[model samples]
Target: MSNRIVKSSNLLNSFRYQIENSQKGVLIERKALLSSKNIELHFYETITRAKDVLMQFNLPVIAVMLQGEKTVEMDGLGKFEYAPGESLIIPAERKLKIDFPSASIENPTQCLAFIPDASLVEEAVYDYYKKTDTWDTKSDDGKIDFSADLLLRDEAILQTVNYLLYLFQEKNEHRDFFINMTTKELIIRILQSKARKAFLNNFQKNENRMTHIANYIKRNIGNPISVQDLSKEANMSKSNFFTLFKNSFGISPNEYIINEKMQKAKIIIQASSDRSIGQIARDLGYSDSSYFCKQFKNHTGYTPRQYERKHN
Candidate 1:
């Protein structure tokens, strides 16, 4: 997957905003960049280091980190570091306490805040279900509800966000139409990403057929597993299994298997120093070390050795 971290040069060239002198009590400065019937985009920059900064939003907001970092805390979600390339989904009417650990005039904290209209979100959800052919199903309502703040590092979401930022700054007659379309795409991506996360987090405890398949895969991840095996495990034909799995999780069975394997590979590489790349590949059921390295790069944008060096 391509890295979602926006390049500093892109932001500096596209978003040209002059920061005003900080008021007596304000910790973060905000500038309204774009406003429309469906959405609003704001540019925020904090120049001074600060802690326990309170922020409240009446509408559900998506904030993308452009530069610098923060430690964010919400009511139910414990505090965590928010860094560049990450996006946070804050629920409507939620209170957030943020700490800017590194902000200065030379390297101020920068982020983009998006307030999507309720109607816009509804339209996106409708389109998501319609395209997925799940609109008429009673089980899947395609609702966007965040139990806690979601931190997203998906490549698709970040690409859409970068496009939206570019569109917001362009001077064109059809800009609004393009922006609306892109915003809907962003919302759909968020929905799919969030659903996949929820399924992964609860699959161990859930008794659903998909969860059962997931459990089986994890239990035997280091073995040679095939789509036919998964279909048999679910007591369904291969074609039906493929359709149902893709519809439920937005990924093919093979893709999910590879994803899980790559995740396991990352843990193994980072947790121990004794294992070589070839040894790790064999442990993950990959007979060829070259193929494993290629798969790892495709999944994580880093080679095994590179990832180990960077993280460990």
Candidate 2:
């Protein structure tokens, strides 16, 4: 029971850290773009760029054109022309270049750029290359339209965006936490408001035993889980449970748990450098120090001590 509690605590903290640290920019230098503190929500007053404003991105980002005529050419994501009120989901695997040829310097354009926690996209949604069976962006461009409601002048959203903007203007340690936390919460709002309906609908339509177990495992990753327990939970025999769970998640439950543990451990190591590796192993509920170190080495190619030394 105590081991379960310790695992639960470690899992909770590490999961949150992974979600928060999911994005790291290779070329980000400013306090604004460099930090993954909060899902970045900023309303740009607009700047007059050369006829073709080209911005290179190492990661995919989203842009919502609130007010202004603009064109976004996504390298692999696709191209979009934004009118006064519309939104676009910028794919991360491509370089995005936008142009505002007709914008007058006298009246700079007003648009909102929503920098979501890149990690959310990294996990929840698959990449364009692998989405042939899912929502194919090029095959069905009309099916991928973004929501314009989020851009409206609502007081709560406006205030939140404004507060984040001011916070990013500073170069301080607090900005890191502020940026990560804010971005995560904002994306959760987006998921709840827009994406939740479609996902819930899909889940309901396919409420089979396998899907149920898969979904439950995601929510209860830190628990002391077993194939027998999960099989019983789904009212299936052990053999049937193994077949279905593997079929759905592409991996068995035990493999999934180990992967989740290593992922959580990586986040904890990245965030808190002062914690001893033995402490991390114990916190993650590894009873044997040597065993945990071996597992960590197998998964990451770096032992726990090496990971701490390099990451810190």
Candidate 3:
């Protein structure tokens, strides 16, 4: 909807100190020497007002802003402001023109970039597909199609990164083991973040159309939706949309819509205990509380009142 900057909980303050005190003449430090088998971590500090510096990576990279802000220009995604505590996912071999608009000698722009092997990302996606049992794994190209640019400042991922950075310093026996495992977990988390849900629903080739419709229904559960309107949105005739929707999601469109409504209803009921069941039903587009209660029971084996009672 609108641009929102996410702040990280686990920030690298010590690393910033290291950069500020490090020897001059080096704008950025390529810490390839400190890299592991699948992941490389690099730190960058701009000393001057650098603009339009071209950069491209052979593998997929996740860059986190540690200090100050940057005006970044990239192919396909265009230009945007990168700030401290924000993490950006850059695709393989994509050209980027970065500007250190706020960089200076006293307060330089510092950033950390984590470059992970493409194969690691593919492995994580394959494992997710296998777990879901939703797609034919044999047909998967083993390439990540991150159609949209992702900027994550998620608490969980920040915590994981903090742990990995600490593990990089510790000389323990299972340090690499933990680092690799956490890196894979980070990949999965990025793919499944709510920010990327809409893109994945509409653009991901395997679960494409119906997933889009599913997310659309979920996003607009409070509003009225008609089969005709949904068919139009899917760019298909009513009959064809219904058939394809059923084939993709294994449930009729109406059923899926109602299920989404009830799911939201449950959340609202649990979250706002002061609100009445009738109000929850009406808010979810159910005109009749009796009908809503019946449907809720049929779907979840719990009436609205009972569900509320148990949760409360």
- Tens-digit lDDT track of model 1 for 1-312: 235655453354445454554557654554435665588887777778888888888766788888888888876667788888887876556678999888876788888888876667657765775578532211133333343326777778888988888788788899888889999888778768754333223111213567667877898889878999898766567999899889878899999999999999999999997899999998999999999999999999999989989999
Question: What are the per-residue Cα lDDT tens digits for candidate 3 across 1-312?
Answer: 112222332334323233332235545422222466777776666656766777887765677777777888768767888767677777567789988776676776767778766556556656665576543221133223333336666767677666767766667888777778888887677666743432233223424555556767876788778888787666567999888888887888888888888888888888888888888888988888899899999988998879989998
Clashes (backbone N, CA, C under 3 Å), per candidate, total: 0, 8, 0
Best by TM-score: 1
Ordering by lDDT: 1, 3, 2
Global CA lDDT computed for model 2: 0.51
Ranking by TM-score: 1, 3, 2
Model 3 spans > 4 angstroms off: 1-33, 135-149, 194-312
Better of 1 and 3 by TM-score: 1
Give per-residue lDDT, candidate 3, residue 238: 92
**Top-scoring candidate (lDDT):** 1
lDDT of each residue in 1-312, candidate 2, tens digit only: 111101111112211122211113321111122234435443443334334455654433444444447777756545656665344444444565777665443544555456555354333333221333332112122233333322232333334444554455556777777665555444434343443333222212213445556655666654556778777666557897788778777888788777877887898899998888777777776767788788889999999778878988
Candidate 2 root-mean-square deviation in Å: 19.1
